[model samples]
Target: MADQLGSARRLTTLDRLAGGSKKGVYRLRLDDQTTVILYVWAADENFWPASPTVPDDPFTDASGADLFAINHAALTAAGVRVPRLLMLDRGGRYLPSDIALVEDVGEVTLEALMARDPVAAAAPLSTLGDSLRRMHTTLGSHFGKLAAISRGEAAQARCAEDVVADRALGHLDAVATRDARLADAHDRVVAHVRHLRGAVSARQVYGLVHGELGPDHVFVTPANEPALIDIEGLTYFDVEWEHAWLRLRFGDAYPALRPVDLDPHRLEFYRYAQVLSLIEGPLRIAETDFPNRQWMLDLAEWNIAKALTPL
Candidate 1:
């Protein structure tokens, strides 16, 4: 964190930067009248196992800033609402697998705004839907396939494979093998994800989608314009992955907006994928919110029963 005057100045101290699982974001005021943003290197150093003892291939926040900028540019070029790019740090060399940089954008994120008023949340949902439709209809073909080994697939085959493996052997025992329920109830989530995948994609139907569609990545500005951020997981395979995710997080509440059309079987698979993502991420975020583990168990049972149903 260094700050130099004139141009290409590095900000040592970010006024107010908040973040979650992956990156660090900051708000800065430039010499100009309008305010801009600065995003820097910030990744979980201890995220993966055995990395610390080894040569170190930790996920860097350095390269991602540029990638995110590029993604924003691409989406913006396609008539989407994204922060107007002022500058990108191309001069800085990477420290093997490290990333660090800043991007200047206008206004606050939809998530931030929604923090003030829950009812106002619906506005961003509609904008997200419209933006998604544009991306899918126009650039869907360019997105990566959501595979476990694929370049940018986030929580892909892991959850589905876990659940299927569990159910194949038995019920409870199988689930435990897939997920360890320690401080948090991970087993029930694993079972739920597997169950949904089995029910939906049981007959073999899968397709393209946004890959990871959640509120956190979607941004709504002061002007009420909706824009999508964080597209590292822009993927193709498993339409159900997107549908189920949107459903659990936002779909159930917003019935007026229908998820993209896919075959019944594929849709079901997506549902499971989403449930797994929520369990792994948001559910983890709200683990203590639930009174007991029974609540999670109930959700697993419900999803499993649904998955077992014929599509």
Candidate 2:
């Protein structure tokens, strides 16, 4: 790792940063008093196989380091604040998968900041909204996960309704096997989604969306601006999807700075879709060797119940 930095300075400290599921992040300090963030992608097939059940892949044909570098450059160019890239190893000549060294923006995350003071956090949350609006301003011709290697088009764009319906079906299958009530709610949600297909087809606008923009992925810079990190799940979708996530996470207080008029019904549909997507994780974990399998199943049921509730 020190050799990759091209600095002969001795390593002083290495502290592992939390909240990563596939990759490992760490705070690295050199004897020369330089600090940087080290991101290591998992190379093992168990963690990142070529053909996984999930459709999304951060390292699209490119290596993880290259993908991160490209996403950082693209987001930064789009007027969104992101951590500055320093060094990257795309070929994995030195590491297992790929690695990158980036400037340490700050120790505080938006989640932590919001927890500390909700009122004071409003500014950063608003800044986040602006940043997201800027990101979504770059429109896409199609809808789905944007190819990491290319900016011009999506690698696998499909009908928006098709995507939602597929996910809804998966949620239904998973829940139906366990809970009958949740299954019935999922059926209603699926039918509602099917009915919205025509409405989705009529829409023309689509843009880049940070598919997973939870508080942890957003950080505060020393300048107090909200900077985005973890670009793995970056994709292209309706800006309303992003708005739905924001509304779900932060409530109706933070309004999206959108150019087009958004449909409330479409937003509600996407909200339920998002809930269904969230339930998939717990369901998958429940099937695994994890100790809290039953707990995860219960959590999935709870999310289904929430999804069924009126918005």
What is the C-alpha local distance difference test score of each model?
0.47, 0.68
Best by TM-score: 2
Compared with the true structure, model 1 gives a TM-score of 0.58
Q: Write the per-residue lDDT of candidate 1 for residues 1-311, one digit (tens) a residue.
A: 22323565543444745443344455766544435565544444212112111111111121355455555555675666666555555455433333333344345565555666767877766766766666555533222333322344333333333343333223333343334542134445445555644654332233334455566565676667775655544543445446656666564444534446656765555454434333333223234433344555566545544533432
Spell out the clash pairs found in candidate 2.
none
Give the 10-residue window scoring lowest on summed lDDT in candidate 1. Answer: 51-60
TM-score of each: 0.58, 0.82
**Can you write out model 2's per-residue Cα lDDT over 10-103, one digit (the tens) per residue?**
7889998766546788899888887899888874412322322335332133335545666677788888988888888778677767788888
